[model samples]
Target: MKTFCNQEHQDQAVEAIKSLVAIPSVCNEDANDGTPFGADIQHALEHSLELCKQLGLETYIDPEGYYGYADYGEGEEMVGVIGHVDVVPAGDLRLWNSGPFEPVVKDGKLYGRGSQDDKGPTIAALYALKAVIDSGAVFNRKIRFIFATDEETLWRGMAQYTKKERIPELGFVPDSEFPLVFGEKGLLQLHINGTGSNTLNLSCGDAFNVVPGGAVYEGSRASELKSALDELKFEAKIDGQKVEVSGKSVHASLADQGINAIVRLAMGLLKIGEDHPMLHFLAEAVGLDGYGKNIFNGVLEDDVSGKMTVNAGMLNIDTNSSQLSVDIRIPVKISKDDVVAQITTVAKEYGLTYEEFDYVASSYVSLDAEPSITLLNVYQDLTGDTKNKPITSGGATLARTMPNFVAFGMVFPGESKTEHQANEFMVIKDMAKAMEIYAHAIYRLCCNQK
Candidate 1:
């Protein structure tokens, strides 16, 4: 494939990313605007469809505002390029150097909420398809670009699309890192419900896929809680009855690296004699163990996807009931039913019931698979680096929504990951490079197919 991507395309790609980032497309369930995701996400979807239409592709948005798609070329077999528009909430605005929704460029990196996690790479993939079409490449198969709106939450939007539309024979999601991901761990989001204490009322956390950075507790004993937190050496601040604990935020997939403020708050509360079922569940049953070693009685790990990790994403405690939202990444070899059984047994001990609300089955595409082998050849030919072979990820992507799909490109090796964190950014240079890769990969997969 010729170098159809140029500075013009890169500039356009950056502009597109900024335009979408400017809109805070975090899911707003209370909008009452008839849009399933909210008004902002509706606007983002409209904007994305407009961009695709500008490239002379046929685009369609679900009338109910669930999902959107753009199509180019015409053939029986379709090549799908999947991505999402919605982003995680911007937690602790004080942590950002600039406004989270305000898009800006400094030090050659574009800073914004959705710049790295998905919007940047999504737009990059769009422009890559543009490059191929602009080059007048002959196509052997139709290409479809699927824009999912609810990827960060429960993927309800994608679920609607699949139920109503045709499933592509094969596809790749541009939501993860490069050289390419062939295997992904199973994603399980659970809500543990139990009884709560009348005295201790606490609630915090943003999303299940994000490691909460800060959790606040407001109750009768402020001074005691502060002392307990200090004794535990946790970073926190207390004012009267309100106490806020601080932790580093990262994606839930990398929960081992993040300091969960919710977990910290529970540990501190327990130290100060706060008796609550959820608190004990968080403090004793979970604590800082990402692998659920204490709760499961052993480490749940496999050679295929490393270890099974867990994150206490959200917590709410009141007089009547309590709910703790947990995000778990199960190893590929582990059965979801088996994992759920273990969790159910342990949760009952703490007076809690394990209820899995969302689940994505683990996915593994062999390196020798048709699209996998072809995509790898494209990467090796372009960058000439074979050291980083196909790998597995703890994070779930749209690729796992269907069979014959894998996640490809956007974040490179040795790059700092800022997804689902404050001040999230994507290196402009690296994004432009990803666009070129997408273009060539698409050409080989759809246009230059034998």
Candidate 2:
């Protein structure tokens, strides 16, 4: 845990993160650009690769713009530092004190979308590596910094990288909380399609991984809906024939912490005696209970990774069709098929067709394993917190993209979690601390070996 990160390095890291945050790199599936993710994301990948090259690493950008990586040192064993450039859409721009892509520093916090979720930590890792490299640290194994393109959505970009590149023997993903993540729950995103109401047409949410902060209803029932919402003491705005409900936003994996506006709107609609398959599904089957206990009779729990969580992140209803986008985090020991079967059964009762969208299987690394033990030791040594040991998470990371990989650092314990929410930020001091932790961990994993 010797210090190699200094004030200059911290300043540089912050600048780099701000540069990335300035890019609105939300994934666009329909851009005419040949890039798999879209033009903005491709720009992010190119920018990150140039940063790596400037740091004296051999950089490679995927010809198809699916992924990029920078390599240093050389050996039979390659150690990976996995990260993603793409971020979730910045929903409801009006909610932000500043533009989601306009990076700003105030009161020692960097504010922007992707500031905490990934771009900040990813750049911090790069600077941490830069610190180690600048110190002339000996490399016993090659280190690869993988820049993935499609992490906020499906991991198709990482899939492409894995399909073509050499897999790392051991690595760590800097996309989770410290001291280290020993286990990650399986991430399941799917849609339930069903019959729609002839009179109701509504849409809410933007991503399967984000809890919708606002839901709008634009129809003749706006007045009735507003009255019902007022009766229920729900926060909402009504203008003419449109009503919008407001709720707290957080990552879908931690849906329990968020107040889903879509769910609130559904309750309001149901209270007004308005009926639709998606509305009933939301109000009855998946109310505010994040664990979805009613849907499965509380069968989705485990001691290892705790309870299973569910988030109805999106709701869409039209004259002819309706669909509910759901994000579920299954405990490590739970079978995804079992979870799917239970949800499918419930969907059948509502005459909704369940369709799977994307799934990332759970990943676990024993606390005693090589990189896990090494990383935890580095963190405890640097921070002197033995009480905070390795823990499991509901959030998925690039750790699942490789064998012997686990998520470590970037978010410290007892900090406000603000990754996917509006006004997302990363504390400046935390970024410096994380860079030091990553530097020490990377050195232990990749350097000073025979």
Candidate 3:
């Protein structure tokens, strides 16, 4: 191979990333539409298809609308570089430090909804393939790039695709932390419904996978309840003349974002101080000043992926009662048992009924596993990033499925965690580095026959 660290190869990677991120590949693909992930997914897949075609790889868009490839190399053993093109919705556009769709560059970072998540990494992987092929790197194994959609809400895209076809012997999903992930925790989602409640009526947020942004409790006077919450930390807004609370730097689906709105509202209403169950729950889980328990609760430690987070996302209420729900993502060390126990304990004491939700699990990739080692070493050897060590994370990604799959690098070391956060971004430098890592991994797995 004629050394792929050339300017032309790097430019191709950056251009591919820019093109893919421009598509709003949010979960517009409703299953009913048969476009399971919507037009955005289509656009993302099309972009990948173009790349695959340009690279002279044989491709096929499964009848299910997902696109895959059989980049034959005269070998039965296949290697895969898996990634999703779809992204979680660019929530609370105003909360964004930048526009969700309008990609930008500032202080050496590219900003957009899909910048740091799958798109950035997926494009990099594609370019890596291109670089290797262009450099005349010959191998006996088949290398495939799976461009998937519908990963934001459910992994139907990958699930359906994988079921219909045989996957490569080993692969990586460049959609998580770097230095490689060796372990990932299992996830479960629960949907609790109250028989009924009038005064208890409340619901907030958009996607189930994300922490809900905020919720509303309505009796005869939503206006008055809205008024009471006005002075709180959340900025109260009304849609269709209905009251809603919008806060800065928050999201609706991720649990942590919901906590932002919940704690602020609880602070002014409960007067029970920070130790109050509702306040403490939101604060401790979401990593905020949080009901004044920052010291005792260890609120500042959202490591690997940033912070373990929870959001009081949705609520439903009528004249009789209210149904409150939240989204949560904490570290593996944090017990789900404790989560259930805490909510149950608090609800019983506070005279409230609580239910749990599971949209995605808090996931981490093992740093020492075969796949992780291959991924990390490829990155380190190619980028000379020896100082950085393997890491952990809380943000859920496509790896939640595939029992063995781990999150590789879409986001570089020292970059911000922007997967579900506002103004998500990736750096040009980072994308190039990811390409180098991916190319080396593919060569090691498929070419060298690991």
lDDT of 1 by residue, 195-287 (tens): 867787877999998889999988778889889999999999988889999998889988888999999999998887877878888888877
Per-residue alpha-carbon lDDT of candidate 3 for residues 1-450, written as tens digits (9 for 90 to 100): 325656788777666777777788777644466665676677778777877788788888877676555464658777676777787777666667867777777887778877777777777777777777776777788877777777666677777877888766667778776777654433434333334432233455555455445544334555554666675435676554366654434433234433455445544334323233334334443334322123224542333444445444444444444455544555566566765666555555544555554445555545656676777777787778889877554455666555556777766667766666666778777777667777777777766764
Report the alpha-carbon TM-score of model 2 versus the true structure.
0.98
Candidate 1, overall lDDT?
0.90
State residue 263's C-alpha deviation in candidate 3, in Å: 3.6
Ranking by lDDT: 2, 1, 3
Give per-residue CA lDDT, model 2, range 157-181, as digits (tens).
9999999999999999999999888
Q: Between the candidate structures 1 and 2, which one is better when assessed by lDDT?
A: 2
lDDT of 3: 0.61
Over 4 Å off, model 3:
29-32, 66-72, 96-99, 105-108, 195-203, 208-259, 266-309, 318-325, 330-369
lDDT of 3 at 125: 79
Model 3 TM: 0.77
Instruction: Return the lDDT, model 3, position 287.
Output: 36
| TM-score of each candidate structure, all chains considered together | 0.98, 0.98, 0.77
